[model samples]
Target: MAKKSGNAFDFGLFKRLVGYTNPYRFTFYFVGLAAVLLSIFAVARPYLLQQAIDTGFVPKNENLILEYVVLMLVVLFLEVIFQFLFIYFANWLGQEVIRDIRVKLFDHMMLFKKQYYDQSAVGRLVTRAVSDIETIASIFSEGLFMIFSDLLKMIVILGFMTYKSWQLTLIVLAILPLILYATRVFQKKMKTAFEEVRTQVSNLNSFVQERITGMKIVQLFTREETEYTNFRSINEKHKKGWVKTVWYNSIFFPIAEMSSSVTIGLIVWFGGLRAAEGDVITLGVVIAFIELSQMLFRPLRQIADKFNTLQMGMVAASRVFAILDTDARVENKGTIQLKNISGAIDFDEVRFSYLEGEEVLKGVSFSVNSGDTVAIVGATGAGKSTIINLLNRFYEIDSGTILIDDKDINTIDLKSLRSHIAVVLQDVFLFADTILNNITLNNPDITEQQVTEAAKEIKIHDFIMSLPDGYHYNVKERGAMLSSGQRQLISFLRAYVTNPEILVLDEATSSIDSHSEQLIQDATDKITEGRTSMVIAHRLATIKNADKIIVMDRGLIVEQGTHTELLEIDNGYYKNLYDVQFSTVTE
Candidate 1:
């Protein structure tokens, strides 16, 4: 999980985010130039109106008035062009930078250790990857560049007003300090509110995602009203988060509007008094100052809003950088790479714990020769499945060594080591794709024909062809369209098609019906024939044919031998387990 910063503006995060725009530097520069041009052009219309009123219309010169009007039209056209350029390039730069960031974030996620994911929420990560990145995009498209443009326009307008008449300019700016003070307060308050909004959004997404994923459980337990009540609480928090922002906006904007109106009133009254006192100020100059005042103060209001956008983007960037800066990735420094392995595994006094001080595998030692079938049976929490995880290096061992074909597993290339092994767990996951694609997993080297051939060898090809679309049939999300047994058969076919030298089946048949169990048993026998296999089964009757049976109790191997040898032991753990299961079956 990424830790968020408390500061409103994280300059460290801002600097790093700016680095992602390096690839699009040309577009960024062009947009900046357009912003400057837009500011210069934005002030032209008012200046032309002043010229028409003072120099042309007042003296009754038709030619001069017509020329001024024509010039104003030309300036208006140029402003339109510059405005278009500013908008298009700014959005383009934002999209390009966000696209790069998204790709980099996803690639970084791929290298993170499994433990990082174990403690992180899926919905929070999704928010970072999707919604949060979109928020950051507004920093360019709606926030930063627009702020620059508005600031520049204000400066240019101020310059023109002072040059025309300094005293009137000062009068128009009488309420400026009050507005600035209000804006500062609004910005600070909005920053905190926006952060709260983002937090609540992530919480809401997480809650909704989990509830939907586990809707079956909620309905099975008749927990609809309870879950709905929980949802309402979270939804209220989400609403309140946004309502705070609205409260600030409601308070600030009216004050800003009133201040602007007051400044305009002061300009009009004072300028009228001067005009009545025999032309110390002209109508054209007074009107121009009014327009300039609007040009100056409107951006003050807009800048406050844009700053809110900027703050949200900064918050999002801080969260995103936390993920980017994580160092909890799997280390792969081994130089050894093997194309083929002999599939001999040795676990020498291996010790491990998913959590500190709660040992799951306590100095356990075991070995399997090439092409040997080993079955591990134990009670729940007896560390039967931990062995499979350790063998695959899904979690590192606390002490001792794991080896494959006499080479330390840690010294072998991670990809090369895993390429030779396949795991089929009790809960098999299938993507929402066609059956053929799911089986080969988009491996170009493994053809559709090859998948069909593999399924045929396992005697499940006919079952697949009976479907409406056969190999091309869609399995839907998590294979929800298929029965548990059917999904397991798909898992078996998928593993068989990989043709791994080592295969692991962790309670693969524990959840299926008797018919599906028979089919899986047939497929299992075929797949494990020449491969070094490890079977973890809850049903004691399934492992009768294993070459070696290792019975475990409380993270220690209590007995080991073939089924008959273990059964010969008097009142041993394996013998007792066998007796209980045999009696249950006979009854």
Candidate 2:
């Protein structure tokens, strides 16, 4: 874990940024060389001017004049070439670094336990992935290069001026300390302003994304005016943030420009006086000092701009680090393989909690034999799905061991454990792709024939065939083109295609029409014929044929046995749930 930086401004962002350049060492070296050549060319132009004035024009040497002009052109062309090469390679390196970071961020997000997602908004993650990467990429591609080139130019120009004439150099250097102090002050203010802008932009993104995704709900509630009003308020905040950013940027550039101009004016006055006093300061040297003075201040302005940019990157870096450094709540200690064995599951003295003080499941124990269908029936929030989630090891339990075929699940590899089970959740998500690709999930090795077969077995093949492109039909984002029932069928086929040893259906058929529900029921019955399966549902009809039914209330199993046995008990919880469904069946 990174200890928080005591100061609001993170000086450490530079260190982290530099670390990303490790992979592109060759690019860095080449860019550094190019920067050197570019700075050298800048200093060379001033000297060329000095020579042309002192020797060529004074002596009326046409050949020297022509030679110097041609030399300047050649140096200018060379500088452009080097600049192009530096930018090309630097951008390539920066993009590659950004790509790696984005991938790492995605992988890290996955490793974070479900609770993180429960609290974090989609827009925030999207911003980190897209905008944050962009900021860092800009820092790498342009910001770092500007900094390198500017620093090189500043040092080279200053060093040359001092070497040619120390007295003038000392006089020019008088105001540099003041310039540095002013730059520091400007940077502090600009950084804060930009940071506020970035944060507001993220919030605006979140608000927009949430509103768009839930637009139907908003309309149904007749809250369009309210949403619009809220949106206006956020937009106002965004406008304020943007205005502040512009205000700071506007002030920063003018101050830097004025400071540079003032330094040049002071240099000219003092240098001209010294020359007039017969101080042996040639017109050529004085001209060179003027040019060098301008060159020196250009980089100072660049540093001011880059300081603001670095602030945004640093803020993003801290967020990225927060994610990277977070501990994953789900622990995967299993490495042992459980292959081609009987699928028998046992939950022994299990205890689990999502919150610190509120236990979701306490001392729950159950045994499921191979090929047995166990149904878990409960009210909402009664820990039915939680039991199945544990079976897949989506969340680690607080205590007690879950066993598979008498082997503790902790001893099995996570991949192997998950590979042996398939889950169909209440809400199905389908990627935006061809129907076939969505079903296969880009498993290239899975044959098209197998894909069709899976779809057919789940009774979705005819519907897919009715589409103009059949299996090649593209699913809209999140399968928006399909009805909920159709989407659920595709999801079932996807899970079935995996041919898992264990199947978990969590309220899988609750939201579909009666006919679609029957189809799902048929598919479920066929799929679970010889596999270890657990069904968590509110409808008693869905689990009537289960080998055993476990009824839960308030995180504890209130009743257990066959459907008839639970109905016979006639207790409030299970009896009420069964009576509702049983009455519907009778009607």
Candidate 3:
């Protein structure tokens, strides 16, 4: 919730934005030169007309009049050339700067900790990356440099008017304060309106994106009408936000038009009075003053609109910079690079909580030897999955230490540490791509032949080949083209291809059918061979052959032993859970 600053032009924001243009400084310098040439050409047209009327046409000299007219056409042609150069270079510079900023913004987002994403809205971030950056682009294409050129044109026109007839110029300057004050007030109101428009746009994007992504849930629950009603409310706010801007435009432009008309009338009336007194003010000077007044006032009116563009760009820059300034990135200060760890993991009194004052793992400790298979069984919310999350350093522990191969986990390079570990969750995610690409994840080093070899070893090669396109089959979004069991097999093949030292199966078979479960079980046996494996399963039957069983209750390991040893314990948590599941299977 960033508040709007009272200052119209934030120089600090402007300077920072200008820094992005440094990479294209030569193009911008050329644009500046074009602006200066454009101003000079713009002022020459009215002055050429004055020369034709005063020295050529009134004196009835056809040759002189033709010369003046020819010169004016040449100036007009040059003006058009410079105008084209100004527009082309300005937009090119803007696009290049925004492309660099977008890359930097996305790279920065990649470094943020998972906690930052957990608290932020996807739609709001999308708005910042796409829409807000687009608005900043307008600052260059339509705003800042255009306003600069307009201001220069006005200054040149003013000097010419003063040189022609100082008395008439003084009279026209009299109405300047009123127009300036009105423009200032209009800009302030427009700034507030633009801020509202941006806010509403972000909200609308968030609402629509969430609803669309979760459309399956909405359809399952028959929430169509309720969701539609909610969307209409948000859409209405978006509409009103834009309508306010149009309303301000409606009010301001009429005032500008009337002021321009008044200035022209005064010139005609006063100039006529001076001329009737016998040859004091000529018709050409008076007519040139009319054109000059338009040149001056037109930019003044346009400056207000351009100022709005500048203001919106500043606001967008401030929001984008706020994201870049965040310090929520995961700290990767470890210098140790153990690319091939020995797979021994030890959790020494580890404690963690996703939320403050609500601990999920309270001083839990465990040890898994190299190449050993350990299974953790627990009721839902009993901290079984939290162990895997902490093992991979997804979330830092609040208290105690996690060690890998006798070295503190925090002391290992993050990439090297995770490289040796692979995780296959119950809800496996697949990108919208070919089976081969998804399996290898487009890693050029991991060849298509390597992925096929891994799939064949995991016994999923035949199943994948059964598809119409085999390895080239498009999975579509989230692998929707495959069944739950098929997706699990793909996940298994993905992990197996990585050849990680430590493999984690977090309820990987919890959501599949008996057939799919059997396929996953077979794949799991082959993938976990000679690797340190930790399996979190609710189904008691899945881990019956695990070398060691750890039973957890309320975030504490209440029992730990082999299946037979645990079943021998009187009323042990493991025995109780095993009996209930076993009885259900028997029935």
Candidate 4:
């Protein structure tokens, strides 16, 4: 959380938001100029009315009345033009600022280390990126400059009122402190209300987004009623939050209107008493004070509302800057760019832990020679997949070293290091796009012909052609339009098309049907023939022919040998595991 500079608004945060306008300073000046002109025109209307009534009526001069009326009309016309300019330019400036902010935020998130994503919710980030920034835009269009214009008009009207009749002006002034106090109370109350409203918005967005993404789970488990009740509970809190703000507005606006009416009545009564007593408070002055009172007090009420807008905008700004200020990105200080890699990997006593003090890879050591197919098998939570993650530098290690082609992996450019390795995980993900787009991922250099050739190499081109639109078929979100087996095939083709120097399949075939499993095995064999490969599989039969098999149990490599050699051990770990799996299949 950002430190607040004050109770209601943060001065530091407001200044930071204002700094976004540095790029749009020309629009800032235009809005400022409009506010000044609008304030003068607003005061001139009532002032001209008072002058025309008193001076023009004294001589009964029709020409004088016509001239003042024309002047008032001209002033109204210019006010309208500048009002349009003010609103248009202010909103334009706000949109441009958010555009740049959104881009900067996205680019920052792109480089964030995997742990940040593992800890944060996707929907909450979406709310910060989309709706919250929208609230900040209101700071310009309906907020700060609008509030400035209203406050300026109030000051100018008070000056004219005092000059015209000190006696009547005193009556209006008598009510000023009460309304101003009420406004301050209302603003403080609204500050807390807006905070609740923003918090509820994020919760609601996160809940709905998660439920939609997991709708399959909800339906499969027959928990629709339970989840619906949960949604209603969250939704009720959101409604109550908004209702609290509305309830405050209800009390504040009526009190403001009543105060304005009382001020106008006091002006009329006082001015009449002075005129009867033969004092200098004339009827024209009395009428003008009513106009001035309306002009002044209405803005006072609106200022309270705009202050609420400014408050809400500040709350949103704090959330956005929190993400921008995060030091969650991996430091890429290496200058070495990989020209080519020989695909030999060495992990010398590497140590890693996803959580503090709970090591997943505990001083583990291993190696994979060039063009060798090495398979790693382990029970769940035995660190089989941690090796793959550490290889790509997804999570930094706490100790020891990982080398690719005898060069410390950390000494290679982050992008270049990952570019030479391809991973196909158990849970395949596809975007809501055509198969071709998902395959190339909009990489300009990955031509359609190259993807087709890669698909043929994997023998999935025939299956892809059987789809409705072949490679042009839309997979929908997360490949919902296709079966689980087919999604795995696309993932295989995706990895193959990259032509990586090293391939890692972390149980990629574990969730597929037997037919898809056979297809994947064939593709895997062809792709790993000359390229270095690492396979983490639960199905020991699939890796029976591997050149070397590393058996892991509780974060330690307990056995390392080929299939026939491992089975030759007296009650070896691989023999026991292989016997249990095949026996389970027999049962």
Better of 2 and 4 by TM-score: 4
Candidate 2: clashing pairs of residues: none
Per-residue lDDT of 530 in model 3: 94
Model 1, span 13-52: residue lDDT tens = 6677778889888888888888888788777888888889
Error of 3 at 19 (Å): 0.9
Look at candidate 3 and give me any clashing residue pairs.
none
- Per-residue C-alpha lDDT of model 3 across residues 435-519, encoded as one tens digit per residue: 9988888888888899888888888889999998999999999999999989989988988899999999999977887677767
lDDT for residue 216 in candidate 3, whole number 0-100: 96
Clash total of candidate 4: 0
TM-score of each candidate structure, all chains considered together = 0.96, 0.95, 0.96, 0.96
Q: Each prediction's Cα RMSD?
A: 2.0, 2.1, 1.9, 2.0
Candidate 3 residue 12 Cα shift, in angstroms, is 1.3
Candidate lDDT (C-alpha), each? 0.87, 0.81, 0.88, 0.88
Error of 3 at 286 (Å): 1.8
Cα error, candidate 4, residue 226 (Å): 1.9
- Candidate 1 wrong stretches, greater than 4 Å: 1-8, 275-281, 539-542, 582-587
Local error of candidate 3 at residue 140 (angstroms)? 1.0
Q: What does the lDDT come to for candidate 1?
A: 0.87
